[model samples]
Target: MDLNQRITAFSNLSLFLKNFLSDATKCEATLNDFEHLKEELQQVIQTANRHNAWFTPEHITQALSSWSAALQKDNLTTWLDAYAITSSSEKRVAVIMAGNLPLVGFHDFLSVLITGHHLVAKLSSDDQLLMPFLARVLIIIEPGFDSKITFTKEKLPQFDAVIATGSNNTARYFEYYFKNKPSIIRKNRNAVAVLTGNETPQQLEALGDDIFGYFGMGCRSVAKLYVPQNYDFDTFFQAMFKQQDVINHHKYANNYDYNKAVYLMSLFPVLDNGFMVLKEDTNFSSPISVVFYERYTDVETLKAELQSKADQIQCIVADDFSDEDVAFGQAQNPKLYDYADGVDTVAFLLKL
Candidate 1:
């Protein structure tokens, strides 16, 4: 498809989803629609069956709600930027996805669809089935999308760009592989949190959404807490403990065991939840339920610390948005305009 054709499709898609938005909101159908995501939900679970890809019915409900809300603009002028289909187009895009959470590949899908680009996606072994099923669903929803998108198994052919998400260690490998191309390479990223003294139980629940959703496998999931030195971790634990059924899932239990054993061998002090472990390491990505922490004197110091780790952190879930912080869980549920790596994918598509 030409750039014009691609943009037209995206524009139409925005409108179509927008129409469903109202229906979704009215009937709580968005949450209901997650059942639609379940048949293939196990694909990710199967991939993570050995790891921690437990997709609880509640999580699926939450994911669909988030996905619907994401279709609407929280505050973006364009849905995405069409970077690949410029005058000089990027022909074949090798996309590396993070299997940490379901639909972790949504940004990549938008990047490919809006840009009128071809994607050579290497499915994270931990998250293989959802994206393709979603693509098929979208193609059915809008027949126009069928001809433009295709998925592949082989290494990508030479192309204009490569968008890859990986650890800091693998970044060098991607750079060496795609040096001459226009690429957006994502390094190890963790989400952080700042706690104020007056958090309602509702906000605490939201924090649970951020941390435990997907069993803390997502980069957007909080792996560290910047609480006051005297803050009671017990309050947070009690709130998270409400997810007892979540704590019961076997897939998550497996990761919990693996992570706990590692910590035990390392002689690490960990906060225990029958199956999961919460630690105080500074690592951005946690294996299963283990997360890290640092005590902040106050919100101001916490914000400053977050800024210092800006490149490594995706978003900071703070009660206060002063100095430009985002809402809790917003990082995990990104609006369509929220581009990965600050790249305006839909706008690029529109201009094309």
Candidate 2:
């Protein structure tokens, strides 16, 4: 199909979902009862369980909501536009999905889906289930998508745009391999926050979601904190402790086990036990799912530090850092205006 055809198809798909999301029939438990629009999510999550054999039903359900909300056209446009670039002609793109967090592939999926191009997907072994599950859903959404997206286990296919996500380690290889193509080669990034004096217990409680959601594995999740000098750590910890049960979950425990061993081997200092580790440094990313806290005397100092690591961090959580920074705990849950990596997506896409 041509770009126009693909765009028309995607627009239709998007409209269908917008309508379906509000439909009463979409609440059915059985995939068989789900109509075409809902079938993509329904089938994809079911197949995800089959392929991974690790993701629980709860994980599937959570991811389903994540993608569903993300693809809502009004909310998605900002993020979607980030990948929009005018294609010379017929375009094909290869996308590598990240499995570090659940439904991490959704961005790459949206990149390809909105671009009106064929997606040659290389699924992550850690997160192999989501893409395939999504493939089933997309095919259900638009049957012709079977030909648009190709799933592979071995080598990748040729393409115009390459979207790859990996650690700081594999980034060099991605740059070398896809250097010639128009690509968004994302390296590891961490999220941080600027603390104010007015935060209440309720506000700190919300921060727990930014900290523990997805076990702090996602790039969007918070990894560091910048609180005012003399800020009461007691109040912060008090509010965040409401999620103690989250720390007790089995999946979170597994991360605790693996990261703790590495911490032991390296003898790294910790801030807390069995939950999050902390430290202070120039580095933005931290291990063991810990959030590093730094003391800042004023907003200017915090702004200066945030500017230094702009490209390495995701969202800045503070009272209101203007239209740019996201609200704390809202990192994983973005509003319609929130764009990925702070890039304006819709304008990017329209220009493309």
Worst 10 residues of 1 by lDDT: 22-31
**186: Cα error in model 1, Å:** 0.8
Q: Write the per-residue lDDT of candidate 1 for residues 322-343, one digit (tens) a residue.
A: 5556677565776665565556
Q: Counting only residues 3 or more apart in sequence or on different chains, how many pairs clash (N, Cα, C under 3 Å) in candidate 2?
A: 6
Number of the top-ranking candidate, with lDDT as the measure = 2
TM-scores of the candidates in the order shown: 0.77, 0.80
What is the TM-score (0 to 1) of candidate 1? 0.77
Whole-model alpha-carbon lDDT for candidate 1: 0.64
- Give me candidate 2's TM-score against the actual structure: 0.80
- Count clashes in each candidate, considering only residues at least 3 apart in sequence or on different chains: 11, 6
Report lDDT (CA) for all predictions. 0.64, 0.66
Instruction: Assess candidate 2 and give its lDDT.
Output: 0.66
